[model samples]
Structure formats: C-alpha cells, structure tokens
Target: MITDLANAMSRCRRTLWQDALGAAALMVTLFAGLHLPALF
Candidate 1:
C-alpha cells in the first residue's frame, strides 16, 4: 500500500539524517582531538 511505502521512505530519511549527524560529530571530535594538544 501507499502508506507502507511512505512509512518506509520516512524511516529511510530519518536514518540518513542520523547518519549525517553522527558523521559531523565524528569529524568535529577528530578535529578537536588533533588540535587540542597544540593549545595546551
């Protein structure tokens, strides 16, 4: 049914959004880790 397809699409979109946020956080963590030692 169309409703099932819509639900699947929404779930996929949410998963992708979460993955993007996780990737951004990981990048920020890595950037901070690499630079924090220099600041001390």
Candidate 2:
C-alpha cells in the first residue's frame, strides 16, 4: 500500500513538472508574440 502511494506521488510530480514547463513555454511564446510586433 505504501509503495502504491509513493508511485502515485512520483507520477503526479512528474506530470506537474511537465505541466510547469509547458506553461513556461506558453508564456514565453505569448510574450514574444505580443512584444515582437512593436519592435517592427
């Protein structure tokens, strides 16, 4: 039982890390899209 719980927690942490990275990428692209037009 404890092992199952640990496995689940590890999986959740990995997913959270992936989600955070995706969110950071999205924010970077969004900011670039918003600011790049002004540079021209």
Candidate 3:
C-alpha cells in the first residue's frame, strides 16, 4: 500500500513538472512572437 502511494505521488510530480515546462515554453513563444516586431 505504501508503495502504491509513493508511485502515485511520483506520477503526479512528473505531470506537474511537465505542465510547468509546457507553460514556460508557451509563454516564451508568445513573448518572442510579440517582441520580434518591436525589434524592427
């Protein structure tokens, strides 16, 4: 039972980490897309 809980916690942490990375990438993409025009 303890092992199952640990496994579930690890999965949740992995998912949260992936979501954070995805969100960061999306923000960077949007920021670059908007800022590129300003550089000209």
Candidate 4:
C-alpha cells in the first residue's frame, strides 16, 4: 500500500515538472515574439 502511494506521488511530481517546463517555454516564446520585431 505504501508503495502504491509513493508511485502515485512520483507521477504527480513528474506531471507538475512537465507543466512548469511547458509554461516556461510558452513565456519565452511570447517574450521573443513581442520584442523581436522592435529590434529591427
């Protein structure tokens, strides 16, 4: 039973990490899109 709980927690952590990385990538893309044109 304890092992099951640990496995579930690990999956949740992995999902959260993926979500964080996705959000970071989106923010970076948006920042570049908004600023890149101004440089030229």
Candidate 5:
C-alpha cells in the first residue's frame, strides 16, 4: 500500500544520510592524518 512505500522511502533516505555522514567523517580523518604530521 501507500504507507509501505512511504516507509520504504524514509528508510532509504535515512540510510543515505548516514552514509554521507560517515563519508564526511572519513574524509576529515584522512585529511587530518595527512596534514597533522607536517604541523608537529
């Protein structure tokens, strides 16, 4: 039904959002790892 479709869409959106956040965190960590040693 319509409700099931809505629920599925919301679940997919949540998963994508989490993935984006995880990717951002990973990028930040990688950038810092590459740059921090030069500052020390």
Candidate 6:
C-alpha cells in the first residue's frame, strides 16, 4: 500500500511539473507575440 501511494505521488509530481513548464512556455510565446508587433 505504501509503495502504491508513493508511485501515485511521483506521477502527480511529474504531471504538475509538466503542466508548469507548458504554462511557462505558453506565457513566453504570448508575451513575445504581443510585444513583437511594436518593433515596427
């Protein structure tokens, strides 16, 4: 039972980390898209 719980926790952590990275990448893309137009 403890091993199963530990495995679940690790999976959750990995999912959270992936989500955070995706969100950060999205934000960076959006910021660049919004600001890049002003350079003209």
lDDT of 4 by residue, 1-40 (tens): 9999998888798588888999999999999999999999
Q: How close is candidate 2 to the true structure, as a TM-score?
A: 0.66
Off by over 4 Å in 5: 1-11
Per-candidate TM equals 0.67, 0.66, 0.61, 0.65, 0.66, 0.64
Q: How well does candidate 1 match the true structure in TM-score terms?
A: 0.67
Candidate 2 regions exceeding 4 Å error are 1-11
- For candidate 5, lDDT tens digit of each residue in 1-40? 9999999888798588888999999999999999999999
C-alpha lDDT values of all predictions: 0.93, 0.93, 0.92, 0.93, 0.93, 0.92
lDDT of residue 29 for candidate 5: 100
Strongest candidate by TM-score: 1
Least well predicted 10-residue stretch by lDDT in candidate 6: 9-18
Q: Deviation in angstroms for 3 in model 2? A: 18
Query: Residues 1-40, candidate 1, lDDT per residue (tens digit)?
Result: 9999999888798588888999999999999999999999
Question: Which portions of model 6 show Cα errors greater than 4 Å?
Answer: 1-11
Better of 3 and 4 by lDDT: 4
How close to the true structure is residue 21 of candidate 2, measured as C-alpha lDDT?
A: 94
- The per-residue C-alpha lDDT of model 5 at residue 28 equals 100
* Segments in model 1 whose C-alpha atoms lie over 4 Å from true places: 1-11
Question: What value of lDDT does candidate 3 attain over all alpha carbons?
Answer: 0.92
Q: Kindly list the per-residue Cα lDDT of model 6 for residues 1-40, writing each as its tens digit.
A: 9999999888798588888999999999999999999998
The reply for model 3, stretches above 4 Å from the true place, is: 1-11
